[model samples]
Target: MTQAQQLREAILAAPLETSNFGETPQPGTLYLPLSHLKALRLDAHVVVGGRGVGKSFWTAALQSEPLRRLLGLAASELKGMEVHAGFSIAEHIDNYPNADVFDAFLAEGGDPYDLWRAVVLRWIARQAGKIIPHDSWPHTVAWLKQNPEDVARLMQQPRNWKGLILFDALDRTSADWRRMDSIVQGLLRTTLWLKAYPGLYAKVFLRDDQAERTVFNFTDASKLTATKAELKWARHDLHGLLWQRLINAPDTHGEILRDICRSTQQENVWHVAPEMKSESDPQRKAFETLAGPWMGRDKRRGVPYTWSVSHLSDGRGQTSPRSFLAAIRQAAEDSLERYPSHEYALHYESIKRGIQKASEIRVQEMAEDYPWVPKTLAVLSGMNVPMDFDIVREKWENAPAGALEGNPTRLPAQHIDRGWDGVREDLQRLGLLETKKDGRIDMPDLYRVGFGLGRKGGVKPKG
Candidate 1:
């Protein structure tokens, strides 16, 4: 076999892992996008980002002592801190309230602030060997609220350790948007409440929409909001993350990647050779080593590095690390299967197919979080975007009542009662849809490709 064939097979065999939802991230795979550095700060109480932008990933990573130590190198303040989970979707249901229980608590006029404090109190109680009402949120809340003086005394009596409690996937706490918002608000309120104590802190991972909503309506919501840090991926960060994973591949694949990648003393800190000046520049060289820079043999088709990322961006020009990795993984699989004899491991066409795959995964994730969004957007799959607002509204208006079920995520029925315009506004707010300067509707490539929508001059994927 030729060197190209060896490279192709190695690429085919390389492990391209994505989705940090349920598993503990390996220390080697933890590439901190510079934007996430703020999130690792002990004082950054609230971290916000869109889906697949490391909310759950950071949540899980912070819990691991090894990862925390590694992370501390960048955020020195995180050193010597104990980490706990106040709430998480990946955690056992018993650890936090489920949907029915949360609703019931709200029905009884129970405040989410009290519920969140109960969660904190339980964590404190566990540390102090004081057993509280662990079985019931109501009982726990009542106990925590009734014993404010005791709770204050207990908090003040803390030992030699400083600690951080993490909250992630707040959407799981309730299906109704209002309820979830309230729960998140309460959690933030609790975060502020914890601030009075010197050694204790809370970190919340919230969705962008959740952070932008009325969840921060309280008097000092600004305190938590002031410390908010966004989890964004720069173009260079995505490339750095890709090489980091590629060089860490197992066996012969790892050997080949390490030979090409420049390394730091840290076990998996992979980078292009020192000749590459910028973070984005190394990515181009590293990717060129695999796919020879261009999408094809010529420049007209596009550069894989630019085209791949440009095609995955949301309406706001944000491209997530998850989608970028997914696209590359799918590109490799497609190239090996369809263009085994191609000069590079990944074919340009294969990369386009990868975008489609990434889009599908993104869409599915969106549906899981906002269940009604897919059905709502399905009405316009084949229609070209930048079309008139009235045209889009007509499509939504003509959509059947059964087709318009908007409560799948159990968000409040605010949109269900409102008309198509309201739905349009909500989609825009979520960064799924945007209005062009021409007063027409536009969906971002992050969402458009999976929905089977097409752009006039965009890279087209084969069916």
Candidate 2:
């Protein structure tokens, strides 16, 4: 059979959970059953990370398995339990009246606190299991005016329903810092309001950088820290995922898959070694090569490599099994298409090419939309200095004198209101930039490796 057919058959034999990745499952995504909700009760948790780091997939997985297991009911069961799950409505306010009211509250503008009050009351009334009189808007407003204290008192009452409200895809919202901040604040407040109700829960998924910038306020660290879930992939966990997929492939395909894993590891190590010393040495060298150059070395000059052949290539340290599986599947498919005869060796090359292609697509697509995109990417691509807002702005402002002016480039900062902020947001969204704890930003190793950039210290200046 053709290599693609063989690989497909192998994947088919694997368990559904074993072979899928990211938010939407495909043939090779890894299913990690992380039961984190067991530690949380009566409060919301924020799951945040870079794209393809498995935030949404983890959220979906959490909601799919442990959520149902913990709550003892499916989504349908909670459908009538006075819950609402959706993305932020800040972007849609002008079009949707109900959304407009929430948007106004988020913006913290308007003298009509009563208008805001009426909106909340109506929303509560519309929630599942809520029984409010079907009065006109004016009538509802009139009633609230007279019973303001009563309405406030009712809101204070502890909710006793069992339901969860999930809000995802916040990253897709417009890149307006003020609007983004307001939305997160409004959501947090909404979560607090829901928390007062014993039976209600709210969950939001966001990127780690976005969450740091928008959600985690120093003044409210207690509130923010109390409800945070960070997504991270351990090396062993990633390895388990790869093994699971290989095992799931159909028998013959499974053998080939296993052989590929073994051969890739062996060849990668052997290709790098000056001389073979021991079996463990080959495994170590193989992992180091797969991990790329961005990984840190110890003070004593020892390299620390976490991923194995079974692990995903996380040049940026943000990849999850989903991204890994997606890359692998795409590589395999591309190989099948290009070199129909030499599927074996071609598939390996396809994996490497697929990674490079994915990174290029991310950069190119951003460049196509934002004028400054190419400059931003070029600045990132030609990394002679550490990257941050100031450096980016300096480079952008002085582009006429720099090497990039003659290139086909557009500056996104020129078109967007907050150009620097916009470029940073775009880069972060595309997984090219990551925020460190000290507020510094850096590229993921995957991007650096795919672009042929050297890692820290070991890298030399190139012309």
Candidate 3:
């Protein structure tokens, strides 16, 4: 068997742990299947990624049995650990039957630091199978209010607690945008406060946009950047994931995975047939030469390649393993639905068609929440098209004269500005855009992959 096939066989035969293949999967819901957890062991770090990238999955996977084993904790000893894993107290304050707690605390008008201390103490007490004594809680609250230094001292006392507190969905808070500054301030404060406590670590998952709007002011990039882990996919990681899924899947469908991967390489050749000019582009010639034997294509067609090699080379090829796996899952589902009886014989064309359909589905899903998705995707598709605030503003102004005639309330110019702002926010949230020192927005290599755009300084595709 070929080396690729041998690798595939080895992965298939290995015992699998998780099915999640994304950056931030939902916590307690999706499991992030990554081999890196073996490295993390019992350490704490911030996981940063866009929505649906698999942050929660990674967090949840860390709580899995294999991880606890790595950390030397028995299953029974980790009972209360799950309580510490969730978003801010605001999300779960209602679950606390003591309405008086919020009323009294808010009435006293304490800084967020004090308020968080009270809430956390109460949460911990509750998790330990004991309620905070009603009378003692008030005294503790008063003590916290009177002696902030004492509270800090008490937080330093190392307890036997051996689990992590995961703060997720910070971007999902319903707080007004104007309040973003204070909200982020409170979050960072809580992180710092929690970190001081012994045997307690907090993991705050945030999107890049939310980080900019909230956490950027309080914490320096160097400090937070070291703790930050971006949720992009590496090609080998993608391959491992696919192999794991194929191996663990029912034996009936096992061969299909290998066939699909092999066929995808073939279909890519056909799709980019026109772009393979040997004489005019020697680099293209070399790439084709390397890929030709596997791709089964001898000549360079004028058609452009769908995947960007330069971006992949820079280690930001795909947005996340989630995107790659989502595409595969969708294609597989489509194949089974279309030809259930003989899905094993699924043609390469069917999978390619499924990928196109899946891409549209993914776009539509994101667009539901983000209105400017279509335009942002269009911009990405328009390779060599410079994107800046001025360019975006011009596009809004020059939109066909009749485009905004129907909506009397929505002025074309105003709508254009809104669209630009929305796109910027959405892209930043998705980690597709980053702000430079000069405040100009730049697209990352991961974003270029879907649009077939090259990396910085790479060859631009002909329009």
Q: Candidate 1 clashing pairs?
A: 175-410, 177-411
Q: Model 2 — which ten-residue stretch has the worst lDDT?
A: 267-276
lDDT of 3 at 363: 53
TM-score (C-alpha, index-matched) for candidate 1: 0.94
- Sort the predicted structures by lDDT, highest score first: 1, 2, 3
Model 1 weakest 10-residue run by lDDT: 269-278
Task: Please tell me which predicted candidate would have the highest TM-score against the true structure.
Answer: 1
Model 3 agreement with the true structure over 272-356: per-residue lDDT tens digits: 1121211225333322221222211232322112242223222223444445455445434554456444323222333344344
**TM-scores, in order shown?**
0.94, 0.58, 0.58
Q: What is the lDDT of residue 155 in candidate 3?
A: 58
Better of 1 and 3 by TM-score: 1
Every candidate's lDDT: 0.78, 0.47, 0.44
Off by over 4 Å in 2: 2-5, 8-30, 33-44, 58-83, 86-128, 131-160, 172-174, 214-221, 242-316, 337-347, 361-375, 379-395, 400-445, 448-463
Better of 1 and 2 by lDDT: 1
lDDT of predicted model 3: 0.44
